[model samples]
Target: MATLTATILAGGEFSSPTDTPSGRLDTTGAFPFVGALEVSNSVSTYKGSAVAISSNWILTAGHNADLNDDGLPDTVWSGDFHLPGYGVFGIAETITHPDFSGFANPFINDDIALMRLASPLPTWSIFPSLGSAMTGDNITLVGFGRSGYGSYGYTSNATLTDRRFGQNVIDTLDLDDEGSGLAEVFRYDFDDPSTTGLPGGSLGNGTETIIAPGDSGGAALIQTVGGWKLVGINTFTEGYGGRFGDTGGGVLIAPYEDWIFTETGIPEPGVGCLLSVAFVLALWQRRRHCE
Candidate 1:
């Protein structure tokens, strides 16, 4: 319910992209986190957003799991994971922080969720790597969230921008009583004359890259160890100031690696699924040999 203003990149005006061809996970050369999260209740299925941080796990907002507005507990799901060019995979597991409550108070820190897969994905070409708590560095953001007054849906590719802040929650929202997280990353809008304290220049200017309906739990990457590193997971986003100018919030990932590892232990869901398949294959092999 809090609001802030962010500048929108004018038509025909946007950031320059890396000349390198975007890989398979890249959606429209923009934010690929838009269509990742898919929630299923008995009545119907709703699509949230998510990003594949590791081969077997995905990062997403915790609110996606809070099924009822009353905030008891929602059925968490990971089965909707899909690459732009790849088919959908069934999620074998869902995990969240043991301490996550459906409330927003501390502002930042506690809005991230991770899901384990039954098997690690062999490949996803265009996916961006994750990053950590270093500010001012540049990164890209893409989502199917609201772009402008008339814009919506997933992006085919991502837009690059300089990061303004690192590892902090910029905003928060309550979804049907369940709290959602928002990770703040700043990008400058060169087009806005008032960018430096201009009248409508609170939200950093660029293509409005905030998450809308389908973008949650997507990965936030930073350059580390020679490649883009996974740093944060999209948790919550809201239309701050006006609707166009807004910020996204997510959970910083590095701190949660241990929890993720411990919670998702070895012989992961993926391994189990693989083992089951193998058993079936072995049974078939024995039958054929006997025949």
Candidate 2:
């Protein structure tokens, strides 16, 4: 485990295991919903990250469905995603926010989308809800992204981590390019081990971790009275020259609760209980360290 933290403009890995820092651990137990998208029927063809909001519906970044500029997809991978164990799930539908433009100005307005699986998952998992996020709140990020930054930029498939979780604190809310206030986004500081006075990050091993390229559409989990609640989906990391500690935020889900419930047919948020560990949805538990 190497403690090298940098923004994955798009991924990273480490050298020897004893490099004086730390490495991201595999997220087999911590995140049950966290999974990768192997596009075009190939695991080696890392499309991006996706999380199961419901057994039959997955949540991911809107841009994952973007078409290639040349209009030829052979240059870029597309189509159904192949999940290990669970098999392939074709994209029955993709719904990005109507107001969403590409990753240009005001990217925070709406960068999320929901994908309905052609088939349902084997079991029902605890679905995350649209909740509030405030600055200084400690959150956990879980993704199937690479481990470190590479020569060109963030490393991809370098560590080949299936699921990686890290800790980070909310740094700011939404502010547009010109420093004007925006109503939709919440930002977090990307901690570089070199910097002093920053949150420990989502990875609790004292290692400063970040969302790599493959981490797109990952889960930003916040501690709640009822275990951990999924609040935001991994979206963009804004920084100059792909540096660490840049502003990374996503579409605040709380505001779109109505749209998410209506579109996905997951039923309106009425009663949600812990699915895996079998806890009451209203238990109001606290995470051990992130609190």
TM-score of each candidate structure, all chains considered together: 0.58, 0.70
Instruction: Point out where model 1 deviates above 4 Å.
Output: 2-35, 69-73, 76-78, 103-109, 123-131, 149-193, 196-208, 240-244, 265-291
Summing lDDT over every window of 10 consecutive residues in candidate 2, give the lowest-scoring window.
Answer: 1-10
Q: On residues 100-156, what C-alpha lDDT tens digit does candidate 2 reach at each position?
A: 565443344566677788887777456565576777777777776555532234544
Alpha-carbon lDDT, every model: 0.44, 0.57
Global lDDT for candidate 1? Answer: 0.44
Error (Å) of candidate 2 at residue 37 is: 2.2
lDDT of 1 by residue, 1-291 (tens): 411111111211232321111222243434433234556777666655566655666666655565553222465432566545444655676665655554243343455566665666666534444435534434344333322321222223222221111122223222221233323322222222124244434223233234334444555556556555666655554443213334454566655556766764522457659989999999999999999
